[model samples]
Structures are given as structure tokens and as C-alpha cells.
Target: MSKTAEEVKRIEEPYVCSKKERLGHALGVLGHDGANTMRGYTMPFLTDILQLPAPFLMILTTLGQVLDAFTDISMGVIADRTRSKWGRFRPWVLRAGPLFCIFMALSFLKLPIGVVGMCAFAGFMYIATGSFAFTAVDIPFWSLPAAMTSNTKERSEIIGGTTTCSSMIIGLTGIVVPLALSAFGKFEWTSYFFTAAIIAVFAICMYLTSFKLVREHVVPDDSVKFSLKLGLKSIFTNQPLLCVQIANVFFLLSIILRSYLNYYYCTYNLGNLSLAAVLSTINTIGMVSGALLFTIFSKRIGKRNCLFISALVCLTSNLVLYFSGWSNVILLFTCAAITTVAIGFGYVCVNAMIADTIEYGEWKTGQRNEAMITSTRCFVTKCVGALASVLVLSSISLTGFVPQATEQTLGALNGFHIMYSLLPAITMVLAATPMFFYKLTEKRHAEIMVELAARKEKKENK
Candidate 1:
């Protein structure tokens, strides 16, 4: 017999769990995507492998990411309105997972026929198309956690674990990629493609493993209508969600800047491309360790407080890095390590807070739209990323970065330092300011959940 809406709503027992197992499952999904074959590999390829000019490369990458912002949100709406035998988000993840992997692998292929401009165009299109497929899987994958469990502590642990594992995988890639390139005695585009292929395979395996370990709660039919107008309205009307979204925009922008500059810093200033990978690995380790610690602390101090604290730590670390003398690699590493930890700590709380906001929406409007909420998060993230790419590339132009210069002048080196250090530090401080107003406490969340449960029961009885 086909299950009625009431029966589906009644089957809530599947959401229960110990924090550890839930964390593991969440980590699996995050690691699969976060090492992010599309993201971690693509931009570098465009800059280094294709040898596209910085300005043009930035424009293409930014446009593609901006397009993804819209695509991700739209996919979220579709997922929210969807009904499938495998529940709301999981079926989409399962269906899109392999295709995403395939496209990621294909995106690395360089064409022989195209001259510089044509090759650049082809590469940009390939990445943009692959990113679209990625959004199809990513939107719902993130949204699933909101529907997974209502316990705030468990949610924090889950998010924390996921972020930690993802960072670790990313860190491992930093070390592995350079070593692989050196080992193969290759510096041409083929090395880049081969490395991407290896990562793609790993990502696919991890995603399938995650799919097997994780399960989704059935979404109620009472969720919001999946319309563009409605999605925008909901986001604007939800104050707490909006604040978090804004903060995430700044946070992600800072991350993009850091990523774009890290390569420049290593290659030009530090005089070692390999050091970029080592620094990235160290940064990832700091992130993993911080996430684990944050999960422990969140149990005692709560998510909101933890977020505030992490933000403070991040702000302080950035400031320290920005002002310290250029010769101090140890000081820079210390600050970077601190900031990485802050990001790890803050990310878990941010995600849990988003899940909490979903409950708040359900309580107020009697609508559960996990996909839309997740998409809202993605929208802000992508916009920030797009903006950061523009800023990085534009700054490169403004600072007179001569990419082909045999010897980098002192002025060019200084410009790179300022972009890498001072700019991101300033932005991160701004990002931390809005969190003071976020008001979702554990008591408040429990109250909201109770009211939502009552509303569900009333609708079922009717």
C-alpha cells in the first residue's frame, strides 16, 4: 500500500542516533565533495595548465561561479518539491553522484586544436558545465542533514565531523598532488589531467560509501512551494537565516582570496611552488584538529556561543598575520593555523545554525524546505567566491603583476603580500560582526520544535 502523508510524517523514529555514527556519516559525504575535484583542481588548471592570462581567467571563472549560484538555488527548490521512493535528498545524490564524477574527470581534458583564446573558452565551458552537474548533487546533499535529526548537539557533531574529514582530505591532496607531479617527471597539462583523474576516482568511491552509510527522513508534503519568488521571499523574511547568509558571504570571500593568493605567495614570494602544497596541508590539519575540538566544546557552550568565539579567534589571527613582518614565516604559519582552526570551528556551528533556522521556519509557516535553505547558504557562498575571484584578479592587474616576468620586482612581491594578507584580514573582521545578533538558543530551538510538532499533529488529524 502507498503510504499516506500522515503515515510518512508519523515515521520519525529513523532520525535518532548516537553522535559518533552521525558524525562519521556526515564526514563521509563532506570528504567526498569537499576535496572537491571541481573546485580544488579546476582554478589551478586554468591558471597554470592552460596558461590563461589572470584577467581573462578570472572573468571566466567568476562568470561560471556566478551562474552556479543561481543554478544551486534552483536545484534546491526542485529538491524540496520533489517526492521520491528514496526520500527527498538521497535519491538525487545517488542519481547525480556518478555523473558528477564523470563530468569532473572529463573537465580536465585539454584540446589540441584550439589556440590560447579558444582553448581557454573550451576549458571555461567544461568547468562551468561540470559545476552545474555538481550543484545537482551538492544542493540536496547539504540539505539532507537538516532533515536527519533535530538534536542541536548531534547536528553540531555531525557538521564538525564532516568539515574535519573534508579538510583532512583536502590537506592530503595538497601533499599528494605535488609529489605525484614530481614522481611522474611531468610538468605539462597531462600531469594535471592525470592527478584530476585520480582524485575523481577517490571522490566517487567516497560518495558511494557515504550514500550507503547515510539515510534521510521523509519530507512532509507541507513544505513550501518551490517557486523562485517564494524562495527569495522566504530568505528575505527569515532574519536569522539572512544574517548567517551575509556572514557566510564574507567568510567564503576571504577563503577564495586566501586560496588565490596562496599559490602566488608560494611561487613568487616564498620561491617554492611545493611549499604551497605543504602550507595547504598544514592549514588543513589545523582545520581538522579545530573541528574536533569545537565538536567537544559545543556540547558544553552551545553552537551560537561557539560561533562567536571562533569568529573572534579568526579575526584576531588574520589581524596578526596582516601586521607581522614579511620575513616571519613562523608567525604567518601560526596565524594561518589559528585562522584555519577558527574556520573549522565556525563552519560546524554555521551549518547547525542553518538547520535550526529550518525548524524555525517550519514552526512559523508550517513549511519544511530543507533544499531551499541549503541553497540559500550555497547562493551566498558562490556569490562571495565570484566576488573574490574578481577581487583577486583585479588586484593582480592593479598591482602590475607581470606573470611572465623572469624576476619579480620588489613592488610586485609586496603587492602579492598585501593581497594575501591584509585584504582577507580586513574582510574577515567585517564578517564576524553580524553573528552577535543571531538569537537561536537551545531552549528557543526546543520550543520551536514543540510547536512544529503540534502543528504537524493538528494537520494530520484534519
Candidate 2:
């Protein structure tokens, strides 16, 4: 047999993980996603329901997210150093879930304070929910996949399964929130508060349940004491993690920019706001499908190839959509669906790739910084999302868009097209660029795991 065939055979060895445990770990994000959905409502709630100034909302959100991104790194360091009986990362989901959800609930309250005071209150809630509370859970929760199992295929399954579950949560919220909003009527502050509270409750329950079910099977060696400098070095020196981070930022940028413009595209360019719902439904379906298919795709083409191909597909679809124009509504929806599926598939690929880097870092640095490496996922996401929102919002303001107007100006329409099609294409090109530099293949990762396992066993016998 060829050496390549032998390596593939060796790495396919099974790792033990029960369905219940996998379910438990996967369930960890229910509350986070639930609360996040409610948080997504904050902008419309503040601007439309509470009638807050756009400038105030802008400054508060942008600042809060930037703060949140920075906090993620620190939280990662803290999680890595944690040595409780409940395990380094699992206990955090239980500890931080309620408080995080509480802040989420509070963010929606219609305070009786004056405009400036209300803005201050909202800012506090925003920062507390995301920067402090969410950061505590996010690093630990994501770090679990690396800790759960060392098997390459199993790790892919775990990450892919979790993403599939998240997409389902998104789909569920997408359906339920609109119905709740319709029943409560438009601009009803009470509706926003009530919905947020319910989501918080649900999130808290899921977090608790996940805490009970998830187990951290892969514990770090106690002999390797925590060093802040070393943890920082581990992150800085890991080329695979850096490449994945840059790629994800641009990938997420394209998705967010297109999403922000969807409403404008439906309302003005397509002359039907209801079609936004159709496109959204397609996007969600695409996400779930891509996530479900990731394990299979990653096995065949490998994770790096999956990332590269997904980005290329997204870029091509967007370019076609841009040049083809929106003459056919059906064609536009098709492109949107295709792009989201690619986005979904690429997201899972990056996460699994990130997990692989944990072992790579350990192999290279002689220190395993799982949470520290995993923290980049949260860091890049928050920072990129916040920055993207600022860019899109600023672009919208410049377009002379008038809310509630029957028609938008030609410039506004053109701007929507650029955001929806052209901008995403550009970002996808950037997203794919980093993939060229991502050199961590599955065979390499498998070899690293073997060497690390041997090192661990030798240390134990001594």
C-alpha cells in the first residue's frame, strides 16, 4: 500500500464519544444564539421602537463590540488557567449563562430616563451582555471541540453538528419573532421587552442543560503552568490560526454586508419588501444544508480545500448575480441561496481548521493553548461584525435613504446593488486569498496528534 493510504488508514481510528455527550456539547450554544437573535433586534428596537437617535445607537454599539472583541482574548487566558473540578471550560457555561441572559433582557427594557440617560443605560447593557458575559462562555464553549476528542473526523462532526444546530435555532427564531412582532404591532416597546425576556429565559435553560451534559475529555497537562506571555506567543506564532482569522473576517464581512442591504434590495430594487422574507428563508435553509454536509465535504476535498472552494463558489455566484443584474427575481434568490450555502460550509471548515491548530500549536510551541487559540474565532467575528455594521450604516446614511418613503432615489438603489452584489464579491476575493496560505492539511494534523499523544504517554509513564 502507498504511504498516503497507510496514513489515511491510521488516522481513521475511532474515538469514543457518546451521542448524549455530543448532544450536550452541541446544546451549549442554544442560549447564546437565542440571546444573540434578540440582540439583533436591538437596533430596530432602539431606532424605531424607543425612538433613539441613530448617532447614539451607532456610537454605543460600535464601542460595545470593539470592547467585546478585546475582552475575548483576556477571557481566553482566564479559561485556560481555570482548574476547577468541573473542568476548565464547561463550568463557565453554567456560571455565566444567567447573568449573560439577564443583561440581554435588560438591554430591551424601555427605560423612563431622558434620551442621554437611556443611551447610557443601553450602552451599559450592551457591553455587559456581550463584552463581559458572552465572552466568558464563548471561549470556553468553542474550546470544547478541541478538548472533546482528538480524532479528526470526530472533531469535524462535533463542530459541524453544532453549526447545524445553530442554524436551526436561527430558523426557529426567524419564524417565531416575526409572528410575535406582527401580533404585538409595529413600534411597540412592550413587544421588544417581552420577547427579549422570553429568549433570555430559554437561553438560561439551554445553558444549564448544556452544562449538565457536556464533558471535557481532553484535559491539559497540569505541569505546564499558565504564562500570559506564552499564551500570547502561541497565538501570534500560529500561522494557520492567523490565516483562518483573516479569511473568516472577510467571509463574515460579505455575509453581513449583503444581509444589511437585503431590506433595501427588496424594498427599492425589487419593489417588494415581502421578498426579503423569501430570501431570508432560503439563506437559513442554505446554512443548515451546508453545515449538515460539511463532514462529508471535508473528508473528500479536505478542510482547506473546502474553505477555498466555498469562497470561490461564493465569489463566482456574486459576480454572476452582479453582472446578470436583478432582472429575474428567481435568479437573484438562487444566487443568494448559493452564496449562503457556501458561507455555511466555509464557516464549519474554518472552525474545524481552528481546532486542528490547537494541536499544531502544541506541537510547535510545546504548549497547548486551546482556549487562547479558539478565542480568535470570537474575536474576529465580533470585531468584523461591528466594523461591517459601521461601514454599511455609514453608507446607508450617505445614500440619502428616507425611511418609510414609497421610493428611493436612483443613487440609493445603485448603492444597494453595490452593497448586495459588488461588495460581497470583493470581500469573497479577500476571503479566498488567505486560504492560499493556510497549509495545515489533515495528514499533517494527524501526524501532530500522534506525536503529541506519544509525548503525553511518555510524560505519564515517567
Candidate 3:
């Protein structure tokens, strides 16, 4: 054997996390999911509870997302360059998690001001929660799995477990929030604030606990200094990360629109607001079940196949729901269940694929920007959310949707159907389109890791 081949054969040891650390990571996700569940209700809260105009809320959220785009990149660069005893990602997660929860709860507050004043306050809080607080916490939290382990299987399990755990808790929130609001007399501003406050408290506790429990294992290379130019270069030059972002943009669009429109679908179209909670529970079950199934079958089917299958199932189920109409509640529930299961499967695939790209960036460019790539993911997500908000509210305006009305116009109902079903189906097709160009497979990733391990060892030996 050649000397070079022998030298390259020395692979670095994989860092295996303890069960306690894994649990801590999952707990942090539970906190984040709890806070986001409230954000999902922002559209309904502003429209139904505050009686705000759809167009106004749309414009406000879009502005917030625009600001969010800049913050996401800035936070990513900040996180990558961060150095302390606590490590790059953990300090951000620990410090910013509680702030994220607090800002989120504050966004739902009802003031004595007029509509314009309330709008101004809401916009301020929206920027605070999404652009600043959430940006700091989210970029760091998502970057953790890659920093925690180099072992692909371990990272997959970690991400999968956290996602499943988050889905179940979010599902519980779905069940509980409606009941709480109903008991408190339906969409009251005080009730909304109260619910948001409780979630914020719970989230704070989770973040603090996770800070004490988890630790970062994979230290970043201190040699590669982070600059705006380097960050932009990392994003532009890395092909795999770009492809993942493309897929994520459409995927987020479909998912965010569904979340934003779910309240309208349940309340106006189905004539019962409480049913949204029930559907959330059902989706939670479906997602958890689907994630478990993916864990078992992903190795055999491959991640790309999982993505395509999920898109196919989601697209088909949504279209079927659109054509069948909402008269059949049972059918609606069936389709929702099937679609969420596919979502659960697809969620794991996307996260795992993103984690794999961290190594790919390092191998190809000699600079690993885990948090920067994660920030770009956040950027795509916020931009898509902004676009979805505009589309939903524009449709609302066109349909002449009445805020807090018991009865909606036929056009408004049709709009809900399109937003909930047809739009998502079309976007699902777009979401899966980029993955076809994604060439990084498990076998290829394994080879990259081996090469990276060798390169690192050689650098240290020098």
C-alpha cells in the first residue's frame, strides 16, 4: 500500500453523546416548539381577537420578515465567530432562548391604544420576537446536532427524536389551547395573553435546564476566520447547502401557509373553531408515527426517495381534499392525518440532509460554517413565511373576508380551500423539485467524513 493511502486510513474517533445530553437537546426543542405554536396563531389572534384588518396584519408580518432576513445572516456570522468557555452555539441558545420566549409572549399582548397604535406595537413586538430573539435562539439550536456529533447515525437519531418529541408536545398545545380559549370565552385578548404567558414560562424553564445538561463536542477550526466575505463565499460556493435551501423555501411556504390558514379553515369553513385543536392532536399522532416509520425504513429506501414519497403523498392528499370538499369531515381528517405523516417523514429527511452538508462544506471548501448554513436555512424560512403571509392576506382581501364573523362568504370559503389545499399541493411539487439535483447520498457522505477525519489528523500532526 502507498504511504499516502496508509496515512489517509487513520480515521478520527466518533463522539458519542450520553443519553442525558440527548434528552437535554430534545428538551430544548420542546421549548422552541411551544413558543412557535403561539406564533402559528398570530394570524387568527390579530384578525379574530384584535379585529385587525387582514391587509394590515399581512403588511406588518412581511415587514417583520424582511428585517428577519438580515438578522438571520448577522446572527449566523456572530454565532460562527463566537468563542467562550461555553462554546459557540450553546451560549447563544442559553442566553437567547428565554428572551425568545418572552418576546413571543409579549407580541400577543392587548393594549388600550387605538387600531393604529396597536398595529405599531404589534409590529414592534413581531420584529423583536422573530428577527432578534428567535433568530439568536433558532440559528444556534439547529446548529447543535452537527456540533454534538460527527457520527451520522447519532445525529439522525438526535434530530429525529427531537422532532418527534416536539411534534407530540405541539400537538398537546393544540388540544389544550382551544379548550382554554373556549373556557375563557373564545378568542378574548386576555385569554390569548394568558396562554402565551404560560408557554413562555415553560419555555424559559426548558432552555435553562438544557443549558445545564447539554455540551458541545465537535470544536470548530479556529484557523478559519469568519468574515462577511467568507460567509457569502461559503453560501455561494457550497452546492449542497444551496440545494437544501431551495427545497426548504418551498417546503416552508406550504407548511407556513397551512399553519396560518388552519384557523380559518376550522372556524369559518368547518363552522367550529375547536376542531382545529382536534386536528392538531391528530396531526401530532400522524407525525410521530410517520417519523418512527422513517427511522426504520429510511436506510432501505434512501433519503431522496423519502423526500419524493412525502411530496407525492402530501400533494395527492391535499388535492383529494380540495376536490372532495369539506362536507365530509371524516375525509378531511383522513387527508390531514396522511399529509402530516408524510410531513413527519419529510422533516427528518431535510434535517439529516442539512447536517450532512456541514461536513461537505468543510471537505470541499476547508471551512465549516455550521451556524452560517443554519442561518441561511432560517433566512429562507423567514422569506418564504413573509411571502406566504402576503399571499394569504392578499387572498383574504380579494375574498372580502370578514374578521371575527360567524359566517363567511362563498368566495372566502373558496379562498380557504385553495390556500389550505391546492396551494400546498403546488408548493409541495416545487419543494421536491430541487432535491432531484441533490447528489449527496449516504455513501458519498461517508467517504467525505473519512477524508475530513484524515485531513484533521494531518493538520494536528503538523
Candidate 4:
């Protein structure tokens, strides 16, 4: 082979991440999903206990995303500027643990205060955790693997491990939260917080542990300082980053909407709330299984190819549910399981692709803006999650949904069908389209690294 090809092959060996490190990295996602079980109870409790209108509840969600989106951008810019012995992201994760624990727990604990309407309660909690508290932790936490290693295979493995672990947590939460709340009953507000508090304790401990085990390998050049304006501008210029962001934001919305819709689907349509556990448990299991399989495929093939397979899975699964009219219980659970598996695959691919974009940005622009890159990722996720809330809740409102009613009208049932099956299928397919344009294959990334290293060496000699 050519001398250039030989040199590129030689440089690739050091970047592959080890198994122990991948496991450590996976532990970090628990910080987000630890309390995820309790999170499943939020909407149900809002309705039965507080009797809040669906529209107003969505207003709180949308407002939080709008208000907190600024924090994502600002945090990204600030993290880029951070200097410490522990590295840029490590300090942020370790420092933010206590605040995340406190605010997240308080958001669940401080509910239904006297004279404060359910509207006020919902507003307070959603903004407190989603916008202000956890946003700090999320941006830095997800940014680590990118900083840890540049190898595509290892990065996919790390992200897949995280996704699988999160699915396991969500699955457990799905089963436990409903059973706990049923035991606590509708009026038992105090009991709900007890569950959340438990989740917080475990969540915080795991987060801190993950931070300690993590070691940042990508050290940026400290001599340069970048304004938030420039950092944001740099992101727009990176095509692959935008492609992944667009696709992922919509993909996030599709799954969250389905998740939010599950309660209504099980309660109103099927007339049994307990079935949510069964469905969620099945879906989460499928997700964990799918992620493990894709992690293997990602190493053999490529990230974009794996992503296409996932998108196809979502599209097909969604279509089956839509055609079934969201009515058949057997089909509903079966399709949800299949679709969730695809979502699991997408989760790993998107994360690995995001890390790859960091390298792309540094190569094209000569700036290692890891925080800026990751922070926008968090912003898109939060913002889309907020928008999904607005859209899904607004559809319910338009259908004339009656909170806490014994039975919803046919119109509302149809709304559930649309939200749960139809829209997700459409968006799932739409999310796949932009992904086709992502061009940074594994081979290209290796060459970019070789080029980046040479550039650094040449500058140092001068």
C-alpha cells in the first residue's frame, strides 16, 4: 500500500477504548435515568391528584424548554472555557451532582402545596429539574466519551452500554413506579415523593462514581479563547453535526411522545392502567437487546449504516401499529417492543455520531470545542422534548379530553391513536432521511485525526 495509507493505519491503534472504560462511561447515564421511574408518574399524578388541565400542563413544559434553552447554549460556551486539574467536563459533573440531586428530588417532593394550583406545581417542578438543575449535569456527562477516546468502535460500545443500562433502569422503573403509585393511590402525594427520593439517592451515588472513574483523554489547546458567538457559529458550519441534531431532535420527540401517551393508551383505550407496566417492560427489554446487537454491528460496518437500520425498524414498527388502529392489545405491545428496539439502536448511533462530530469540528476549524458541541446536543433534546409535550398535549386539548373522567370521548380516543401511532411513525421515517447525508465514515475520521495530529506537531515546532 501507499506510504500515506500505511502511516494512517499505524496511528489508529492507540485510540480504541478499553472494556473497563466503556463500562465506567455507561454508568453515567444512570444519573439521568435513575429517577426515570418516578418521572413516569408525573403526568398521571398531575391529572388524578391535581386535576390540572392538559393544555396548561403543556404550557409549563414548553415554557421550560424555551426558558432553559438559553442555559444549554450558555453552559456549552462556559464549559469550553473551563480550566482545571480534573479537565473541563470532569469538574462540572462532580460539582453539579449535589445540585442535581437536590433540585430533582425537590421537584418531586414539593408537590400540591396549599393555595398553589396544580398549574403552579407542575410549572415549578418541570422547570426546576429539566431546565435549571439537570441541564448542567447532562451536557457535561454526555460529553465525556468524546473526550475519552476517538475510536469509533469503542465509542459506539460505550454509548450502547449506556443505552442498555438506561433501558434496564427504565424497564425497572416502568414496572416499579406504577405498582408503587397504585399502592400509594391517587391522593397519596407524600408516597410519590418517597419513591422519587429513593431514585435520587441511587442516581446521585452512581453519577459521582462515574465521574471519579472517568478520565478525559482529549485535552484542548488552552492558549485560545472562544466567544459563545463564535462557538455557536462553528456548529452551524459542521454539516454532519446539524444532520445528526435534526434527526435526533425529531427522533427524541417521537419516543417521548409515545412514552407520554402510554398512560393514556393503557388507561383510556384498554381500560387497564396495569398493562402499561407490561408494555413498557417489553419495550425496554427489546431496547436493551437491540442496543447490544447494534453495538456489535457498528464495529463491523459503520455508524450511518447502523442508523439506517434503526430508522427502518422504527418506520416498519410504527406502520404496523398505525394500521392496527392502536386498538389491538396484542399488536400494541408487540409493535411498541419492536419500535423501542429501533430507538435503542438509534440512541447508540446518535451518541457515537455526536462524538465523531467533535473531531470533525476540530479538523475543519482548528478548534476543539467539545463542550459547545455536546451542549447543543443537550439543547436539541430538551427543546424537542418540550415541543413534543406541547404538540401532544395540544392535540389532546383539541380533542376535548376530560381529565380524570371515567371514559374519554371517541374524539379523544382517536387523538390518542394519532399521537401514539401515526405521528411517531411519520416522524420516525422523517428522522431517517437526513441521516443519509452524514459523510464522516470511520475511515475518514481516522485520516482527519492523522491530519489534526500533524497540524499540531507542525505548529509546536514553530
On TM-score, the candidate that comes out on top is 3
Q: How much lDDT does each candidate structure score? A: 0.69, 0.79, 0.84, 0.76
lDDT of 1: 0.69
Cα error, candidate 3, residue 144 (Å): 1.0
| lDDT top scorer | 3
lDDT per residue as tens, model 3, 154-271: 8888999998898788787887777787778676888888888998999899998888888888887777676667667777877887888888888778778887787788888999
Candidate 1 regions with alpha-carbon error over 4 angstroms: 1-24, 34-38, 116-127, 182-187, 222-231, 404-406
Model 4 residue pairs with clashes: none
Error of 3 at 405 (Å): 1.3
- Model 3: which ten-residue window has the lowest total lDDT? 1-10
Please provide TM-scores, in order, for all candidate models, with all chains considered together: 0.88, 0.92, 0.95, 0.92
How well is each residue in 1-462 modelled by candidate 4, as lDDT tens digits? 123545776765365556666776677767667665466567666665666777677778778888777888778877778789988788877878657776666665544355356567667777777777777777887777777876544565676677788888887777776667667764567767787788888887877888778888877766776655657666989998999998898788888888777778877878877788898789778888878877788878888888888888888888888888756788888888888888887887887788888878887777778888998888887787778767767766788788767689999888888888888878877788897787878777777778876887799999
lDDT of 2 by residue, 332-408 (tens): 98998898898888878878788888878888788888899988888887777677667656655788766556678
Query: For residue 242, what is the lDDT in candidate 1?
Result: 76
